[model samples]
Target: MDVMVPRVAALPAAMELLDRLHDQHGPLMMHQSGGCCDGSSPMCYPQGEFIVGDREVLLGVLDLRLFTGQVRPDAPEDADGVPVWISAQQFDAWQHTQLVLDVVPGRGAGFSLEGPEGVRFLTRSRVFNESEVRALAQQPVLTGADWDTGARPPAATRPQVVTDVADACAIPGG
Candidate 1:
């Protein structure tokens, strides 16, 4: 069986910030900014607070547990991680690249939950190699529409990764 390539992952810094955010704000969600005030930074929010709409694409669920060494009270009981989303248009433009959620020292987007934390989420991307692109082509892409209907990736695919290199060198995109 072929494993699907994860579309998103996170760095250790991001995981640490997320752990702090999760502790303060609860389960979290991340969205790629589609030209918000912060340009294209990844925006983090408390889960269930942002109502993702049909135009949003669920890139992948990021399991930060390994990098942060913290078990989140993540909401999606089935996934045990945070969901990362992008606008459908943005996904179309970035389909060939994989996202890496990194953290930088700065104020986050005004509307994002991390604003007060003095750290902002950043999105670093890499173009996929031919084999990875091919493998990803066969993978199912989930969307907000599917989520609203209570759909989720099967258990096998749900643990989409987001870990630091030292912690998870085995996870390709992570």
Candidate 2:
């Protein structure tokens, strides 16, 4: 009975920034930037603002509790976590580690929601232990492009396929 490890989690400071952004904007989502400029930084957007295609992978919700690796029983009942995403290809390269979202003093790379706040969102990672990796692989990884219509999965759009967990690594979708 292992605690299910989250593929992505935000540091408390990063969560604080997310809160500020949510107050200014609205429901939010994040995408992992892999190309020029950002060099693997995380981009934030208003939920439904960014179009998720087949190549995107839903890293999982960034609930306040995810960083602790456990969903608190006393957590807010209405906690609809901020969804985080990575390119499908990025997921493959990062699947062996845990993706940690953090904030730093600087301007965000692109149109991420936090750009104007004088702090930029960045990703810091840790290689998962064998047990943690197993836990992550066993969880259902949602592939955004499969049925995502700029909406979150398992409730808004069609539920993501969970059977794909049988793949080489656990996070299920593509």
Candidate 3:
């Protein structure tokens, strides 16, 4: 019964990306996965391909596919293997947010984008620093080394696992 919508602050960027996608792909849905804090970030899809009721928007030249999901949370620690933890409540809140955007060409065979407002300049190149790729791979949504290959792993893989060790401390003869 919990209806999760993208935070309203992301609307402008989402709308812009949606329009650009429509212009390029002629109304289709654009799907993109990857984020800093959550599992899946926002990406745009062309109009008809991802029909939101009856509105069709376009980007410059790329078609988009719209899929709903949460943004990938930031790595707990930087690539240095530091420890990080986001509370379950905070994570749950983020899980309900949505993003909309289109992928654009990068300088050296990579991609950039028009993401949520202040984040429009965000960009990534085909060549990733060894550490950057490693950090991204740590996300449940990205499995193995295939993340760098432009393959979307799966949403079901993002759940965090926790194990209680108290039972292991039971005394045999206390």
Candidate 4:
């Protein structure tokens, strides 16, 4: 199935959260739970690992290690017939925290964004169902998935220079 990379437009709330994360934590990693075609959500590694589906995407950035993987199309169906993508272990770790998936529709093409908060609609071309949102939110990560254990490296140290290039290039007498 053809998968598309979703475009992220952080809303005020999302942007605030992102800034808070950057200021307190570090870079952000993303993942997703649901989408079209076999109902598989493709895992994307934007900075680290960002998962993308036909209509949803997830963005994550944390100090803890987390499991991740792609959802199988033929996976066993939940009570609602929507397949489970993410694994149980991952769910336990992410429990209590709300994950949001944003959906966007384009001309014959569309994408979604999923994170630990609310979902944002990107485009007006496509339609989605409540079940679809739940399915996407329910996507799972692989058991024993890799995690980011190391702390984000400190921002590059500013170098000490003898002279400023711009000032040095200025006309001496001018």
Question: Predictions ranked by TM-score, top down?
Answer: 1, 2, 3, 4
RMSD score of candidate 1 (Å): 4.5
lDDT of 4 by residue, 89-142 (tens): 344544333333223332222232233334332211122235544544454322
Give lDDT tens digits, candidate 3, residues 1-174: 122111112222333544453344443333233344524433433322322211111111211122122222452211111011122333344323221222333221112223332343221112223554454345443222333353432222221111121221223464
TM-score of 3: 0.24
Write the residue-wise lDDT of candidate 1 on 36-146 in tens digits: 577987888888778898879988877656454545453445333678999999999999988888777888656887778777887887677899988988888889999
Candidates in order, TM-scores: namely 0.82, 0.74, 0.24, 0.22
Please report the candidate that would top TM-score against the real structure.
Answer: 1
Write down the lDDT of every candidate, Cα atoms only.
0.76, 0.68, 0.28, 0.29
lDDT value for model 1: 0.76
lDDT of model 3, residue 72: 22
* Sliding window of 10 residues with minimal summed lDDT for model 1: 154-163
How do the residues 1-174 of candidate 2 rate in per-residue lDDT, one tens digit apiece? Answer: 345566766666777777667657766788888778778789999888888777788877765333333343554522436788888888888888767777789896678888778989877765777878677667667787654554443432211112221221334353
User: Which number leads on lDDT?
Assistant: 1
Better of 2 and 3 by lDDT: 2
